[model samples]
Structure formats: C-alpha cells, structure tokens
Target: MNPKNWQLSFFRREQRSLFGEILDWMLTPLLLLWPVSLALTWLVAQGLANKPFDRALIYNAQALAQLVKLSPDQQRVQFNLPQPASELLRADDADLVYYQVIGPKGEILGGDRDLPQPQEDEKLGSYEVKIRDDEMRSLEVRVAYTWVQLASDKSPVGMGPVLVQVAETREKRSVLATEIIKGVMLPQFAILPLAVLLVWLALVRGIKPLSELEERIRARKSDDLSPLDEKAVPLEVAPLVSSVNDLLGRLKDSIATQKRFLADAAHQLKTPLAGLRMQADLAQRKDASEEELKHSLKQIGRASVQATHTVNQLLSLARAEGGGAIDLQSCDMEALVSEVLHDSLPRAMDKGLDLGYDGVDTDSKRRFLKVQGNPTLLKEMIRNLVDNAIHYTPSTEERIGVITVRLLVDPYSQALAVQVEDNGPGIAAAERERIFEPFYRALGSNVDGSGLGLPIVREIAQRHGATVSVDVAHPGQTPPGACFTIRFARASNKFKTNMASGSADL
Candidate 1:
C-alpha cells in the first residue's frame, strides 16, 4: 500500500482501418508491376512480328539478283523482267513493295529508279542477301540488298559491281504486333480487378474473429469482470488478451479491498459514536446531581476523544492504501526512531510505562544508520510502531511496563533494523501475522485502540521494501512481551569500524 496518487492519462489517437492497411500492403506491388509487364510484352511481340516478314524481304532480293545476266551485245549488265513478274512483285493490299538494281557502271539496270540506295560504307556480297531498315517516301520500311557479279570469269573493263535492293512498307508487321499484344494483355486487364476483389475478401475473413471479440466484450455487463479466454484469440493477439486479463484481476482485488476497508471503518467507529451520544444524553438529564453531571461530562469527553482518534486512524490507513511516485533518499533511520520515541514519551509517562531509546550513536555512525526510503513515510512507520508499543503494554506503579525503541546495524552488510520491544502481554504465534490486518485487535487486550497502528507500520514498511516481523521480547518470562522489527535493505556506503552505541531512559 503506497501513499500517493496512481492515476494514468491516455492520449487519444487518430483511428485507422486495419483492413484497408493490410489490403494496401498486399496489392500495391502487384498494381505497380502491371504497367511494367505490359511494356515488356509489347517489345517481345514486335520482335516476333518482324522475323518472318524480314525473311520474305531477303527472298525477294535474291530473286531480283538472279535476273541479272549479260546483255545480248554482252557489253554491260542488263535487266529483263516479264510484265507478269513485275506486276506480281508490286501486287499487295496492305503494303507496297519496291526493288532496284544499279549496273556496274552506276546505270539503272531494272526495276523502280526511286528506291533508296544502301549507305556507301555498306559491305557488298555477290548474290548474298543482307537486310536493313531505311525510309522511302517518308514512310518506314524494311530493305534487303545485295551486290551481283555479272560474270564470274570477268566483267567489262570499266565495270565494277551491281547492287540489288528490295524494301516493303511496315503496315503488315504492325498489324501482327497489335494482334499479339491483345492476345497477351487483354486477359491481364480482366484478372487485375478479380485479384483485388479476392484480396478484399481474404482481409475481411482474416479479421472477422477480432470483430467478434469486440462484440463479445461490448455485450458484457459493467459488473462482469471475468477474464477473456486467451486460447480463443489468434496466437499473435494472445499476449494482448492476457495483459487485459491481468489488469482485470488487479482491479477486482482493489475493489474488494476498498469494500472491506469501508465496512471495517464503519463497524469500528459505531461504538464510540454511540457512547458519545449516551454520555451527552446523561449530562442533560433533568434530575442529575452535580457529581453525576461531572461524571457524565467526563465520560462524554472520553468518548469524543476516542471518536476523534478513530477518525484520524481511519484517515491514516486510507492514505496508506493509495499510491504514487515516491522521492527516495538515504534517510537517518535511527534519528526517525529517536524522534518517535521522544514524541511518545508523554503518552508512556501518562500510562506509567518506561519508554527509552537505545542505539548506535548518530554522530559516530550516521552513514551506517541510513536507510533508503521516503522520509515522510519512514517517519510515519516509526511513529506507528512506537504508538503501538505504548498503547498495548500494560503499566502500573508497582511494576512499570518497559517499552524500548532500538536501532540495530548489521556490521557486515551495513543494513539497518528498527525494533520496538515491549515487556507486556505478548502476541500469540498463530495471530502474529493476523494482527497486521486493519481493525484486528488482540483477543484479551481490553484496550481502547484503533488497531490501525501495526497495519500502518506494515504498509509503510512494505512501501520502503522493508520486512516487518514479530517475536517474543524475552523468552520464558511471565510476561513474554512482543518485539516488532523492521529490516530495511542496506543503502549505505563503506562503514566505519568501532561504532559507538548510546541509550537513554525516559
């Protein structure tokens, strides 16, 4: 039970769609690659369309080369083709075909004269066909050309070589490439949308369980704090569900503690309030004597004082039950103990009990006496232990009850322990732990105490990471008495040897 605020604040965040995010991740790469696939397919189709058409242009050029032979005079190369053959060459619906042959002396031998010539740097072969892409009439065309030797034996003295060339328009090749593109790309256009639809359906199916879980949680009643079944959720989400279950368990325990505290406080306060009311009524009686009136007033004062003490104790316990961040320091544990003993001296004297302080000297071993904890809480814890000792120990003039607060230091570990020991009716072994529970008093103490002192001590000790334990102060004695020791974790540095000890009786 820590004693400060423990509230948490959560910032509101912008909401997002999980389904939309997942779908985008799955389909973005596919959509991005579609256009790239289309471009590559178009390039491949163009290559396929040109292969057979290019071969046909080479064949036409070879046929034209065969037509070259010696003229009748045998003076120079001549071209002679039948009208049917020439008409057959030009006959085409989609594309126009053209051919040209230049004699060895740069004379036009046969065929169309308007055809474009190959570049001068082009290699020449005798009846060997070659192909190139060139332009005629501002339109793109494929050209096949060759150089022809009129006679293998010899040519005319001034003659060198002859050139034969053939070209055709690109319309037919374009049409075939267009057809191939449609064959491959049309199906892809249709399937892209289908793929997107399937992705949407798959995402919807994947998160369906989460939606159902949300609905189940929403339908639960406010008081129904039962844990969610971790096994029912997906493996990835199980950790989240488990965390929520743990939080619910803690909340349930907190609610139960608050309820029990309220009930105990009410039960403990009712008796003193009733007594105060009775005493007040008696003091106002119509036929009361002076001595009776004085006695009633005294009783009223005692009851009122008891009521006030109960309220303060209730508030102290409530404060201990809350929690928040604590500022820790290496505090002088022995100093706090001495201060508490000094404060409780009057009460001990009033009850005729011997109150004293015994410990290592603060001036000599101040560093070794330090404990790491919140100073305020540490003081409160020591105050509660001393108050408990003063309240429970029986005192009388003949045999004075002795209550001592001792500060112990572990010479080897440097840890410190604060102990409150009383020579009075001791606590039974079975009820020792139970006595730390709020409002639980000893069975036959016959004391008018809040019973919150030991509980407060335990609470504060726990907050400081200290342990509290009770045992017999003096074994085998008629009144064995009780000793409460709080052992704190060592928080000091190197210790000094030969520590001085001190004690004072009050």
Candidate 2:
C-alpha cells in the first residue's frame, strides 16, 4: 500500500478506545502495587517473628545460669536445675529444647551432651539459627548464651567463667508467626479488591455528566441551532460547550439572513409579475380601440421583458450564492468575452451601437487568458457587465456609443483581468458603490434594469477569488463611460484547460 494508506491502517490498529484506556490506567498501578504490598508484609512478619522467639531463649538461659554453682575443689561447676524448670526446658511432643552449661575453658557442664556450643565470639545476646534434631527434622531455633563469674579465693571458689546456653525448635514460633501474617494479610486482600471496585465505580460516576450531555445533544432536532445551557455543566466541559454554542449562534445568524433574502426576492418578483399578467389580459380584450390595444400590448411587452430580466438576475444571484456546489473549470477569458460580445451583437445592432471584442488574439498561446472558475457563472458575470454597459450607453446617429470587451493576462501575478468599457454617461463616485446592490438603480438613468445584474456579477467574481470594481474607461476625457474590471487571482494549468473548454460554448 501507499504511505498514506499504510499510516491510516497503522493508526486504526493502534487506536486505544476510551473505555479501554481508562481501565488500563486505573488497573495497572493497582496491579503493580499488589506485589509491593506483599513484599512489605513479608518483611514485617519476619521482623516480628524474631522478637518473641528471642525473648523465650533469653528467659531460659537466665534461669539455667542461676542454677549453676561451684564445687569445693573449685575445679568443677555444678547445675542444680529445678524439676519444674527442667520440665519447662524439655521438648513437648516432637518440638525440641536444648540447654547447656560450660566452664570458662569451654567444657560442657549440663543438659544434652550433643547440644551445639554457641560460637566463642558470639555476644551475650539472643539470636535465631537453624539446626537439625535427633530425628533429623530441620528446625528454625533461637539461642541465648551468657557467661557468669564464679566466687573464688586462692585459685578462686567461683571466679572462673561459666557459660549458660539455651535453645528451642521454632515450630511453635513458625505457627504463631504464620497466624499473625494471616490475620494481617487476609483483610488486606479483601479490602484491595473492594478498593479497586470502588475506584472503578467512582470513575463511572465522574463521567456521568459527559454521557448526559451526549444524550441531550442526540435528542435535539437537526435544525435546532440554539445555545445550550451552561450553568449546570461541569467546569471541565463548560469551555467546549460554550464554543459549540458560539458556533450555533453564527449558524443561526446565517440561516436567518438567507431566510430574509428569500422573502425580499419573492416580494420584488411578485409586484411586476402581477402587472405583466394584468396588462396581457387588457391587451387581449376584443372591444378595445386600436390605440388602447396598442398601448396595452406595449405595456404588456415591457412588463414581460422586465420580469424576464428580474428572473434571470435572480437565477444568476442564486447560482453564485450556491457556494461550492458549482464546479470550477479552466476558461479562456478572451474567448469567453468574444462569445458574450457575439451574443450581444443583435442587441447592439438594434440600437445602432458600436459593439466589438477588443484585444482578442487569434494565436492560442496569447489568446488563452485562462482562469479557474465556474464557466456558467463567469459568462453570466460578463453578460451582466456588457448588458449593463449596452443598456446605459446612448444610441445616436451622430456618435454611436461604443462597448468594448477586453481580456488581459499577467503571468507574473498569475492573474486574469476582464474589462468591459462603454462610452456613456458615467456614474458618480458615490453612486458607483450603491449600483451593485439589488434593485438600486441610479436616479438619472432612463434604461430599464433589475439592478441585480451588477450584484450578481460581484458575487460571481468573489466566488472565484476575483475582485470586481468600476472605474473610468477614459479618464479626463469628455463622454467617458463606466469600465467594469474583474481580476481573477491564481490561475493554474489545470484550471486553464477546464475553463477554456467550458467557456468555448459561452
């Protein structure tokens, strides 16, 4: 596939939907936190397990040290351990306890002969160790060892050192610690899921306003362009909603303007149309005198022509206002002007006016003043300008009015300009601006016109990225008439061909 298609496909595949994205964001951290919580709980349990076990061994060792006594010879040490204390030190069931007493020289004094000695450098403090029993069962055990000074004289009665060591298997401690961890971790496990569930619920609740807004919009009619209520909207959504309302306000204004224009156009058309019908009926009356009949017929013909002109102008304006629905094609301005002038030939001849297509080149290269625009609208614009020129120019045997249509192409500016000049009474500077408005005819002009022609031309020119303006055809000269110039910007090769071919018919 091409790069654009490939990129679109990749984007589609990588698109993470809204709900999925939210769920991933909400759940991933919680999942990662679960392992961290477990590790922390294990560390705490291990730390706590050592405390009680160390205390038990310390108590045993201290009791056993008290039972130690020196013999008279002072060379031997004796242990007078009590039966209750001995029983307390004995292993219950399969659990094992070991105790030992040693001389300063590291000789074993009491308890099991097989019991291991504490390391010589081992501090007089409690610690935990793992060891094997007579049954070969591995056990985690705690040991406490301490040295005592014996009372002695003349080689000392009990001055030499004696060590007391006590140890017990950790099966009971293991069970107790396991129970403690279960008590602590089980509730947390339950609460973890509950916490996740609560978080998901809260996210859904927080997003409820957006869903309500969607529903409200979906329920609205297509034509409804009214602003939405913003008072109760969430702060995060208010800005977007306000922008939408602003867009709706603009659209409402556009729709209202179009409706008013349509109403005005109807009103303008109805009045003349009614008069034309009435005049036609009067002309058809059988009993009318010849003079009366002739006058009625002339009035009917004038009204009919006026109505036709008005209708044509209205159609041109409508076409220009239809926006981008019209296709823009390449056209030759010179050829288009020639065709328009040819079409106006009979009208000019009837008035004995001098009509001509000036500056038209026969060579295709020089003749092709190409432009990109809707050809039909382009022709209508030219026809209107030329027609307006023809209607305003005076016709007399002494000096005939001349209407010239010219096309000029400027390659450096990429522009095509069409000019229609007439030798007639020119409009005043102030009236020139108002002449392009619909139904706005100049005060002294005797020519019949709908006044929509110039406006339609202006609209068509604008739609094609062109500018239309009126100026003097012959400045500082007597009998100077109005010159209408349309300058189209940005002519391209493709546009040239389309417009040229389309305007061939015009």
Candidate 3:
C-alpha cells in the first residue's frame, strides 16, 4: 500500500467505533443548522425592529404635511412646524432627524434644502423608506417620504402636489435591531453547547447495553457456549444478540464434534498399533520357526490393513462433517445403487450371500430413482451401507445370507428411497440410534471392521437432505433381520412426481 493510504487503513481498522459513528451523524446536522438558525433569526429580528420605528417616521411626515396650505391668491404654498412637534421629532439623542416641504413646482419651502427629492411616480399616502448617501453632505441617511395633495384643486395653475420628506441618521435603528438580534441569539449560543452535551450523554446512555453485552461475553469461560440473554437487551439490539447466540450454538456443536472425532481416532489407532507391535515381537523371538514367523507376519499384515481402514474412515468422517456444502445436481440413485452392488458382489459371493439391486422399473425406460445430491458423496454413502451389510451378515449351512439393495419412489408422497436389507442379527432397539455415532458398533456382533461406516453414511445422508433409518425386516422372525433405508425428501426428489404414473418410456 502507499504510505498515506496504509496509514489511513490502519487508523480506520483500529478505531471502528459505533458510538463515534453515531455521534458524528447526530451532531453534524445540528452544527450545520446553527448557522442557518442564526440567519433566520437575524431576518426575523430585522423585521421586528423596523416595525414601530417605521410607523413613527411615517406619522411625523404626515403631521408635517398638515401645516402646508395654498397662499390666498393660490399662487404659492406656505408650511411651518410647531415647536412642540419639532421637539418631539428631535427627541432622540442617538439619532438626528431632518425634514423638507416642497411647493407645487418643486421649490423647497421649509427645513433642510439638501434633502433629496422624491421620485415623480412614488406612491402618495404611504411612506417609502430607503437608505442612500447624501453626496453633498458626505454622510449616509435613512429617508422616508410621501406626496400629499394638501389642496383640492385650489391651484388651476397645473402645478404638481407638494412633497414632504423625512431623513434620519441610522444609529438608533442599528442599535435596536442589534439588541433584538442579541436577545434572540445569545440564549442559543449557550444552549447550543448544552444541547450538544445532552446529545452526547444520550448517545452514551443509549449504547450502554452493548457495553454490558461485551462485558458479559468477556466474562464467560472459553468453553462456555451458552446463549446471551436477549430479553435483557433493548428491542433495537435483540436481533444482533440473537445472531450472536446462533453463532455460539454452531461453534459449540463444531467443537463437540472435533472432540469426539479426536477421541475415537485415538482409540481406533491404539488397538491396531498394539496388535501390530505384539505380532512383530512374536516374529522376532529366539526359537521361532519359519511357519510361526510367517503366521506372525500375516497377523501383522491384517493389523496393518485394519489400521489403514480406520484411518481412512476417520478422514472420510471428518470430510463429511467439516467440508463445505455439497454441490447438488441431478443424480441417478438407481445407477449409483447398481454400481455399489456390483462392486460388493465379489465379497457377497465369497461369503455365499445373495446380494443384488432391485431398482424399480430397472428394465423399463422410466426414470424413478433420481434425486439432487453430490454424486460422489452419495455413492460413498451407499457403498458404506452395502459394505456394512456385507461385513455383518453371516451365511448359514442351510440358507445363505440375503442382502438386497432396492430403490423406489412412493407415488402418493413423492418420496424417493434407497434401501439395503440383510437377513443378519438385527440391531437392538437400544443400539439403533447409537450405531450412527462414530466408532460405535452393535452389541454382541464380532464384526471385523472399523465402526466409522454408519456414521459416514449418516453424515453424507444429512448433507444430501436425506434421512437414514434402521428397522427390523423380519420382526419376531428367527434372525430378525435389519433393513437400513435412506429416504430423500420429496422437495429434493425431482423425479418422483414425473415417474409417479410408472409408465415405461418407448
């Protein structure tokens, strides 16, 4: 990484705090609105400050217009202000006021002549106020003026109406407007800091539950996988707590599985290794004949084979349990079952057992035994079941052992099933569930094999969304034979509905 970018990345990774993030989002808008609030407040203050003062200015101009009248001959205008009214207009110490009265032909009649003239089109009977510079006097003034028709057609000389203009220094309006603005805005200057402080406090309190949850988790022992108390958390945080609890549950199961696998593997390896060591010791003894040495070597070879088989089964079980999700696709269950039966036929023949596949509509063209699964794992599952049957079933002098693999689809439920049945000493009710556990074997059956077969079958079955169940084929019969069946769910068994009618294809 570039040095600057790497530093930024490290800083971000170290300070990924939820509280800081939330606080930033919460306070940014408030701080941004502070300036906006000042702008709006300033506007409202200016409007209020101009209200009473503008009314007073307009009244003074109207009162001064009352003094103007046309001369007796109606040729000129006369205007004069009373002393009391003049004193009232000049009452303020901070502001200086000046006024002017203009006659009908734009001649100044009274007050300061330097005052500016009103516009010809300016509306009469309403005060018009504007701030402009007095260029002759070199100063700025706020001016309010209006035109007054003092006489009703008393002058037929075609002269325009008289004008009364008032001008004042802006110091008083500025001071009053500033006072109003400060009155409204000063409180908020103090309140903004307090508001931000309260917001920070509320945010800290809001996230207290998360801190407590972290503390609770840290207090737990390494092996303690119990769930957190979701009820104790706020409603907004319950979902996060629930997800954490789910992760803990899965981790607990995975850890338990690992422990069981290790224990079983150690036990399985110990027995064969002890046997191999003993057989080798016997072969190396001083007075051992050639035949005895050969027997010991044979026993050692068998022990080695058993050890290798145990190791392979352990690896298979681990892979089935811990591997990523299977890549499920359309799999022909009948074809997979037939292949397993063919592979196990030689062993079946050697043991004089009748072993074959009974796929429904095998000779016909209809596809009845199709499912969705990983084909390799599905085959491994079936091979394990068939191997277990071949290992456990014994042939008698009168009748050979019968082990048959069958595949069928139920028309009504649309469920697909693969079954392996053997006329061997059946599994007891107590051991049926335990037989699927790793390194667990049926009681009183001297079977020469690793006990990982059924567990592997079960794990693979579960991965394919299938259930494996064992039941007595001939309940209350002499042998009470066992049948192991793997039933695929209807939802996953794609061909069951299509092949429900059982019509053979042409």
Candidate 4:
C-alpha cells in the first residue's frame, strides 16, 4: 500500500474513535431538560392567573345572598336588588356576568336562572371554578354559593335555606392566564436557542485543540518520529499525547537498530566475497601447477563455507529480533546438550581436544533437569557455544586442549544453567561484553571462522529469557581458560511429571 493508505489503515486499527462519544455526552442532558422546564413553567402560570379573580367572584355572591327574604306567609322567597347593586355584576368589559337565586323548592327566582347546578354533595358557602355548558352557551366561570335564612326565623326555618350563586364568563380569566404563560415562556423561547447555540460553540471550541494537534501531526515528515509536546494539549488529553510520544520514541529506536544491522551485515559479507573472487582468478592462470590450482580451489571452498555460516547467523539474529509470541515447550537440556556435543565431536577430534559432558547423571535428578524454550533455537544456542569452544581452544604440537559441556541446575536458585568451558587462551575481562556484539572478535585471536557464533549464542539465550556471561575457568593459572555460561529464568513443569514416570518405570 501507499504511505497515505497505510497510515490510514494503521490509525483505524490502533486509535479509538473519540468524536461521537464526546458529542453524545455534551448534548443528551440539554435535550432531556428542555421539556421538563416547559412543563414546570406552565404549572406556575395556571396558579398565578387564578388568585385575584377567585376572591372577586366570592365577594359578589356574598352580597347577592344578603338581598334574600321570606314572604309573610313564609311559604315563598323574594329577592329585591336595587339598580346600582345589579349593575356592578356586569362591570367587567371583556366577560359577561351571571348569577342565580333559588327558593327552598329548587325554583329559579332571579338572574340567569339557567346556570349549571353544582353536584348534590357540594359543600355550602364554598367558591369553585369549572368549565361547563349553560342554556345560553358554553363558557368557563368561577362559582360561589351560600345559604341564607329569612328575617322571621320560626316559619322560614321550616321553609328551608335560600340559595344564591354568582358566575361569570371566563374571557377575563383566560386572557390573564394566557398573558402569564406568554410572559414566562416567551423569554425562554428566545433564550433557549441562544443557550443551545452558545453550548454548540463551546463544544466546538473545546475540540479545537484536537484539530490543532492533528494538523501538527499531519505537517510532519514521514521519517520524523519526534515526540509530541504534551504541554500544548489540554490536561484531560495530556495522557493520550504522552502515550503517542512514547510510541514514536520506540519506533525511532527500532528504525535506528534496523539501519545499523543492515550496515553491519554488508560489511561482514564483503571479505569472504573478495577472497572467493581472488582465489578463482588464481585457479584460472595458465602458469599455475596442478597442486597450486587444487590449493586455490580449497581456499575458495573454505571462503564459501565461512560466507554461508555468516548468512545463517544473520538469519538467526533477525528471527530473535522480530518480536512475537514464541512457544516455550519443555526442553531436555541434557538431551539438547548431547545432540550439540555429538555434532561438534568431529571438530573436537580434528583439533585433538578432549570433549565431554559434566553434571547430574542419576536418572531421577537428570529427568527433572529441563528448561523452557523453542527446541530449535535452544539447540542452535548450544551448538554455537560448543562450536566456539572447539574452534578457539588451541591444540599445538606441545599440548592437547580440552573443552567440557555441562548441564547443571543451581541448588539454591533453582535456575537451569548450560556451561561451555575451554582450557585455551581465555578472553580478557575488558572484551567480555563486546564479544557478544555482532561480528566482533576478540583481539589477537586468529581463529579461522566468522565472528557470529558467540553473538548468536548470546542472542538466542536472551530470547529464551536467559543470561549469557564469560568467566575464567582456571583463575591465576597460566593461560587461564574461558567459561561461557547461560542461566535460564525458570524450569519446566513437565520435567517433574517425566521424572515421576521414569521412577515408576524403573
């Protein structure tokens, strides 16, 4: 894929989508609270419009009740009202007024007798408002009713209580209620949108810093892996910026490591290739004897072998560097060491060196001696250590050399260790660490091999969560020999099961 497409895919896979989540949190509360506020405002408006008009309707009914009287025979009722007293009832210009008076027999006696009756259980001398239809038309009105007795108490008491009710068409009350509702809600209608708009603008401003950060990232060159400035971001976003900066720093180090590896690989490959070319040229010369040509061919073969070894080591190092999950199966250190020793026996015999194994040989303890690692890489690591010992230990005409391979577990630490020791010229303390670096050989050593073996040993040991170090085999002796040791982190559980089975079989 192209760079742009690759970057897009990378971010899609790696980064969380943040915009929709932020917007949902900001706007959900505003939408829910808007309708709640409108309902509360409507309730308050209804109460405000009803207070004064209810009292006015009650006062008029009390006055009309005072005009009632009983006849001389006390069998009938009469209500006498002067003109001015009656005119006060229709005083409101916007609404028609209504009133009713009833005798003891439930007969309508005065003023808009068609008024709707109250329920039979309605309490006397109480004021209420209702919306109802009358003989004239349907209207909303306030209602008040009261009981009155005549002046002659004895016969009129038997005649029963007089009834007076006052009512009005509801244009005035409705107008007042509507006015109150508008007063409360109109300002909110204007302010609510303004508030929403202000909130929208605030959200936009809040996210502006993210846009700036994106633009800064987009402006950088493809190869630029510098850290982002965390202080430039909001405090809430600083953690995200810090994480991104850490990733960039690691990526930079990885790229630098790859570049160095490539450079070192090229430099190591050059010498063997030049020797092959020069040897081939010598074999083609007309003046060369048969023996000379044979020697030239032999030299070319040796150079080819060295080049192939270097290439194999490079591939092994690359596999170790590639970070991924590796299956760490239970490994038989003794068996693994034995296989490597068998492979290196021929080389040791050619050098006339004594090569042997050391450590626990009992069946029970031996079966328990296991490590966790990739079997192939573990074997490769053992092979490199044994091969290095065989190659470096000197076998001169005066004295024979010796190399020992040991597989032992530390009693106290419970750590499994693989050790390869040689009684040849040991490495100096100053160069011990450097010897593990790729293509770096110890000074004054003229061994005819690629310098990749020890480095490969160290890299593979590290991949298996093991540590590799060198120490003198015989301290304070002449030509103190070298011992390369690899100590693993933990033991394999399968080892115990295998040991138990072995014990039972025996």
Best by lDDT: 1
For candidate 1, the 10 contiguous residues with the lowest summed lDDT are 497-506
lDDT (tens digit, per residue) of candidate 4 on 1-506: 79999888877865554665666676688778878877886777666766687678777888887788777665578888788888878777987888888877888879876787766665353223333333335666666667665546565345666778887776776788889878888898898788877877887898899999999999999999989999999999999999999889878866876786687679878999999999999999999999999999999999999889888877777666645557889988888888888888988998899998886756645755787789988898889888888888988778779898876653434656677888899999899999988778899998877678887887788778888878888778778889887768553444322221221111
> Against the true structure, what is every candidate's RMSD?
7.2, 9.8, 4.8, 6.7
Q: Count the backbone clashes (under 3 Å) in each candidate.
A: 2, 15, 0, 0
Model 2, 262: alpha-carbon shift in Å? 1.9
Pairing residues by index, what is the TM-score of model 1? 0.76
In order, candidate lDDTs are 0.81, 0.75, 0.80, 0.77
RMSD of 3: 4.8
For candidate 4, the 10 contiguous residues with the lowest summed lDDT are 497-506
Q: Write the per-residue lDDT of candidate 1 for residues 1-506, one digit (tens) a residue.
A: 33332222234455778887788889999998998999999999999999999998888889888888886767767778789989998998999999999987788988778888888888576788888898888999899999987653454443567899989999999999999999999999899999999888988899988998899899999988899999988998899999999988878867776786788789988998898889888888999889999998899889889888888877777667655457888787767776777788898889999998877654545467876778878888888888888888888877789988877675567666777888899999999999998888889889888888889888888878888888887778879988887777642333211111112111
lDDT of 2: 0.75
Q: Which regions of candidate 3 are displaced past 4 Å?
A: 1-14, 73-76, 83-91, 117-121, 125-140, 151-160, 187-189, 327-330, 360-370, 395-400, 411-413, 423-434, 437-440, 472-481, 490-506
Quote each prediction's TM-score. Answer: 0.76, 0.61, 0.82, 0.78
Clashing pairs in 4: none
- Give the C-alpha lDDT of model 4: 0.77
Model 4 earns a TM-score of 0.78
Q: Of 1 and 4, which scores higher on TM-score?
A: 4
